[model samples]
Target: MRKALIVGIDYYSHITNLGGCVNDALAVRGVLERNADGTLNFPTPNVLIGTNDTQPVTKTELKSAVRELFVDDSDVALFYFAGHGYLEDTGGYLCTSDSVDGDDGLALSEVMTFANQSSAKNKVIILDSCHGGSAGSNAIARTMTEISDGVTILTASTATQYALETGDGSGVFTRLFVDALNGAAANLVGDITPGSVYAHIDQSLGTWAQRPVFKTNVKKFVSLRKVDPPIALADLQALTTHFPTADHDFLLDPAYEPERSPGQENDPSIPPPDPEKNAIFQVLQKYVRVNLVRPVDAPHMWHAAMGSKSCELTVLGQHYWKLVSEGLI
Candidate 1:
């Protein structure tokens, strides 16, 4: 069983309410639920979300969820928290909606304790809040260095810096994190793991802005997702000869053939209509989406409007065309 507890808080009457934390949490969960190959990773049922619906995450509820996640020895437990984190001399406290009085929210150290006590074969904790790195800096983490070989901790930033939220309704750290899971961090074999994800985020974000923290005892990484690249080299190569010339528009739809004269056709440049070629062209048309991977650039984009010239090939289309021509995908 692969279980995940995703937490994000936007409603905090005590502290400043964050705008993108909830969105960021959902994005991470969404990416984790599926791989780039369109295969399911951790399904919706295995992933628990904590937000306004389950918000004001009291210490008890958070603790219970953490306990439930790691109860099974064979399960892979992953926890992610994106909210405010307050640090004191004692420990770091991740602020929940219920935390009203002081920084007395759910203690991250205790959270680590729950994670450490887990019987899970693999346990991963990702902290996306402010000063979340403090959890690994505590006495327990320092003293008990070899508690478990499968435990991995990934923090958004160092003990002092705040995790930034983007204008696009996602934390900057989480956006790249999700992107890595989706495809960015994938190896040539399509496997994407925690280590690769960390590398992706680390390289993307400079050390001065935010320094992500990582502590892992596992030798082999557990894969989170697989990235399957589209656009087959064979498919692209097969499309070459039919491509449009520099001055001629490749007719997208055979039905859009201009009225042909009976005696003789004036345009030798245009290929005469043929049923066999039209069938293959129609089948190939499936690759061209409007404005995305269109073969033509101008009018009559989809279904061939009356005046729509052969839709021009997009930049991406041209790139693939070149690659195919050069025997590269």
Candidate 2:
């Protein structure tokens, strides 16, 4: 059966400054659950590190967790981490609860070694931490030699910038990463591709000051075997247009819409007597005018629109309405 090991650390005493590691751990789990095929369904991986518990993850705990999670002859193995990452004098160290205590903390090399020791056919390592490298440094270099032929490594940022904490006290990368993973319930089976995960995290954090970087050397076949893309806007628009109230709704409710700015809050863009609902309805109308693709079957529309693997605008169904309503095609 396939197995996954997800760890998030938001409470490292020394690296208490780092954000979202715990939530990141939860998010990674969500990603695996949504991505893993039910035909090959497997038990949840044991979580060894993070803020959900009291004590922090120790080297012994981490090593033990790795050994247990990547048992011999497993079909697939996945490892995810969200925590303080430091490029130390030795190499890259995934700072753990015990890391703050002494030098026994887990090293990137050691983590790689453990994976190499495993019997899994496919392996993926996801790290959302800062890289300790110089300008022009190849963060991929850190794991290239260590990664087996079937292994892939995805990091949160390039070797330069530090991963940031959101105002809510979580890492921006983790927040976006988790949000995307959680969104999978609205997508199709086997639709959670790695490219889609990257897109999810990418768009989720693109506007932020610090964006994460994803690096890989594994052949596309092995690395991307189970990856899927995010739900497309056209798909969401279509769902709303057709069923308008499907159980697995992808559209943001009026309550979830971003509030109007101070300049427009009291005095809405729409004039009086339009009905109070017009405020939100007007915004929704504008969205529908600009975003929906037209004239397609429900399934086809779903695929054409929400099947976006990237952040680009996808056209489906009624391109006519979008143009006329938004004054552009």
Candidate 3:
């Protein structure tokens, strides 16, 4: 089972209210609740958005929710917080609506403790507020941080930086995060992991901008979502079958050129096109489109075929071929 506790506090009585935290929470909930194929990824997330005329998001309330979220033994437990993050001589705190001068809200250390002690197989903590990068760090020591096994932390910015908000009522980090979940961070086989999400966000942001932080202690990454693969599974698996060896080149002739097939402009000078070869050529063309196959001694596949040249697997194609040979695809 997968559970998520998503908190967005936009209404703070003692501090400047934020306009986009609630929106960021709602957007995150949308993506986490469903995968790209419209299948359930996680159960409906426990969402708490602070707004006027409703119960305020106090430190106690947020802490209680987080504790409950991590108390159970489950496959995955995820906690997301978007609000004001206060950092002082002690440590970072996820500010609540009841935050005051000296005290903010729940301490980042406290949150990390809950995650570290969780019974869940995988625990993910995502913070989109300022100083969020301080989540897994030691408050007093500053140099020593202990992240237990299976815990992953992704924060929007470094401890000293501020996460930006767009004029469109969305957090800048979250906008890219939503895009990443929507398949921007997916691998060739469509798996989107927390590490990939961090990479996507990091690359999308300017070097001079706020940097996203990623800390994890897991043996293997868990797929947060899946999208349609760039190439069909069957086609991917056939890489080894077609290449035989990674460096092996597949010879081509005029029969492999669909344009040279019968009923089209006939190249009388060349041999008649074979239907079987043409069918194989179609699959090879698909590989060419994705840069897995490249013509050798010719500029294009068509030229390779017409000139009786050959095509070989690209470096990337060889990698996939190795995976296929090992039955890893």
Candidate 4:
């Protein structure tokens, strides 16, 4: 089970009510629930969201939610908070709606304590709000800061910087964060993790802007989401549309008639097309290597002499086609 405690506070009795915190929380939940490729990475049911717009996220409720999320030994625990954060001598604090003075907030040190005690092998915590950068640090003394092994913490900004948001209810950090998950943060191995996401977002922001903070003890990355293929949806659709069922064999040599085998994805013959080779095959080869298409049926003659020749859409290809044809992606 992958469990998330998503808390977004927009209403406060004494402080200025933020316009974007709730929206920020929803955006994170949406992306984690389903990646841009429409794959269900985190289900809705497993994500527990508490918003001040509907239900108040009191300090008690926040603590309970945070504690409950880490209870399951088999779960991958994720905690995300988007709201007002405060800096005090104790540490960073995640503010709740009921918080009036700076003291009435969830202490960051306490939150980290819960995170450290979690039984989950993979624990991730994300704080998106002002003063979020203060997390995992002691404000008063030059004490050594530390986190338990297997814990990954990503904050919207360094402890001293404010996580900026627009009046339009969008977080600058989160906007880039979501974009990073949608292929921007993908590494050479085609996997995106918290560390990569922080690096991507941090680099994209200007030097004066908030810098995302990432701390990890785990050597191996745990994939929270899978990015879309490098090719754009429109490009993939353009390629798919090139090979209509009724269309003539566009790529294969006219002499290789009966047998059809698409060669190895990188089969020297496949590259960005020029007049020398058919343009359609170039697209097919790119997408095939990315696992969007495959040889549809057994080959007879036209199939690559020994490999494959003509191609068919794989299940993933069909899914992307549906998304593209309908302009969903």
Candidate 5:
């Protein structure tokens, strides 16, 4: 089972209210609730949004929800917060609606404690507020951070930076985050993990923009979401079959190009395409489309086949070949 607590506080009685945090939370909930195929991903995320005229999200409420979220012995427990952040001599705090000078909402260190001690197999915390990078940092040392095993943290900015809003009811960090969850961070087989999400967001932002922070202590990453694969699974698994070895090249001939078959307009002199070879070529073409295979000494797969040249696995293809050989794919 996977559980998520999504909090977005836009209404604060004692401080300047944000306009985009609620939207960000809702957007996150939308994506987390369903996968690309409309299958359930996480059960409808527990969303807590603070808006005008509503009972604001108090520190107690947020803390209780977070505790409940992590207490379960589930596969994954994810907490996402988008709101005001406070950093002072006391450390970083996720501010609540009633935040004051001495009393911020929940301390970042406290939240990390919940995550560190959680029964869940995997704990993921994503913060999209100012000084969010302080989430994993040491309060006293300020230079070191402690992350427990199976815990991962992805924050919007460094300790001193401010998370930006686009002025259109969307945060700059969250906009990219939503995109990442929607497949921008997906691998060839469509798995999206926290590491990939961070990579996507990190590269998308310019040097002058706020930097995203990632901290983790895990043996393997958990897939946060899945999308349609760029290449079919059967084809991916066939990598080893096609190459025999990673560096091996599969020879091609006119029989591999259906276009060179009899009755085709331009290639009457070429031998008709062999049905068996043509079928194999079709799969090879799929690999070529995704950059797993490339024509040798020819500009295109068609040219390689028609000229009786050869095709070889690309660097990425070799990687997949290794996976296939080891039954890892």
Candidate 6:
């Protein structure tokens, strides 16, 4: 089976405050759990994770947890993080909660080394923190350091930019991130592929907050191949490897089908109204209190609310699913 390690830290004793990193991490876990199938190609990911707000997330604990999760026999393994992060100056490092000004911060290379040693064939890293940019504090290391072979790294922004920080809510980068993930899979884009995710979040963030940025590095990696959506357990079984994409062809394939194929399949000319998409949409509607489709015309309170959109629902749903599936919610 595949494996996934999700970590989120919000309440930092000395680390920077992260209001929504842990929430985002857990939400990712939810999507992973619902999507996992125990087939040879598409196996359920065994999840391992820790959140700072819910529980104490220590550096040593995190290191050990990662080692245990990325076993030699694992298949598709994923590593996700949402928390306060910074770029260090001395040796070009990304600092985490445990990081100190001098030498405590975990080096990006160090995390990559652990990931490389894993046995999983396909691996992905998602970071929702900005690389350092403030000139005074040891120039932030923006270099795209290699983490692992055949590993894809998706960041909220490039080394030079900082993720958006609204009044007192999720970082703009991560907020848009969860939305894209939950919403992308069911859209015509097929499953929420990394590239598609980058596109949606980057655009939304740019529109909402000008400086918002998202970036990724694909080193010796092949793009995801789309398969028909899972209908039955048998269908899931047939899909040995299913990583949905936002490609037009995948969405339009005559033979390819999705879980909630509505109007389109039977009506031919019409497209489907994704219920999973609707559920998420509803959650967003309830939380944000505005129709995403009609946000421009909605009340000003929609924009003013701190927890707009089904942010809480999506976040909690993902967290609960990950914990139940991975045995570590």
Candidate 4 Cα RMSD (Å): 11.4
Taking all chains together, each candidate's TM-score versus the true structure is 0.65, 0.57, 0.93, 0.68, 0.95, 0.54
**C-alpha positional error of residue 261 in candidate 1 after TM-score superposition, expressed in Å:** 39
| Stretches of model 5 off by over 4 angstroms after superposition | 260-269
Poorest 10 consecutive residues of model 6 by lDDT? 243-252
Which candidate model has the greater TM-score, 2 or 4? 4
- Residue pair clashes in candidate 6: 41-240, 42-240, 99-105, 283-310, 284-310, 287-309, 288-308, 288-309, 323-329
Score candidate 4 by lDDT: 0.71
Q: How many backbone clashes does candidate 2 have?
A: 16
lDDT of each: 0.70, 0.54, 0.89, 0.71, 0.91, 0.48
How does residue 225 of candidate 5 score in lDDT? 91
> Candidate 4: where are CA atoms >4 Å away?
45-54, 138-143, 188-190, 231-329
TM-score of 6: 0.54
Off by over 4 Å in 1: 45-55, 140-147, 229-329
Stretches of model 3 off by over 4 angstroms after superposition = 260-264
lDDT of candidate 5 over 1-329, digit per residue (tens)? 99999999999988898899999999999998888998999997899999984768989999999999999789999999999998887789999987875246899988999999988999999999999999888878888989899999999999899999988999999999999999999988999999999999999999999999999999999999989998889889988888999999899988888784445655567787799998999999999998899999999999999899999999988888998899888
Please list the residue runs of candidate 2 whose C-alpha ends up more than 4 Å from where it truly belongs after superposition.
13-19, 34-42, 52-54, 101-103, 132-146, 183-190, 220-329
lDDT of 4 by residue, 1-329 (tens): 77777777888767778777777778778778876668677776244344554677788888888888887774578888888889866677888888888678899888888888878888888888777766666555524556787788898887778888855777888788778767789743346888889888889988887888887778677887876547755566574475553222434542323222355444566332234343455565676677766654444323541333556666666666666667655
lDDT over C-alpha atoms for residue 153 of model 1 = 87
Q: Deviation in angstroms for 26 in model 5? A: 0.7
For TM-score, candidate 1 versus 4, the one ahead is: 4
- In candidate 6, which residue ranges exceed 4 Å CA deviation? 36-54, 90-98, 132-148, 166-168, 185-189, 207-329
lDDT per residue for candidate 6 within 190-293, as digits (tens), equals 34566776677666654434343323344433223232332332322211112121111101112212232335457755344455544434333432331212
Error of 5 at 154 (Å): 0.5
**Candidate 2 lDDT tens digits, 240-319:** 34332222233322232234434644564323333443343343333344353221333332232223211112243234
Which candidate ranks first by lDDT, i.e. highest? 5
How far residue 24's Cα lies from its native spot in candidate 5, in Å, is 0.8
Candidate 6's clash total is 9
Q: Largest TM-score belongs to which candidate? A: 5
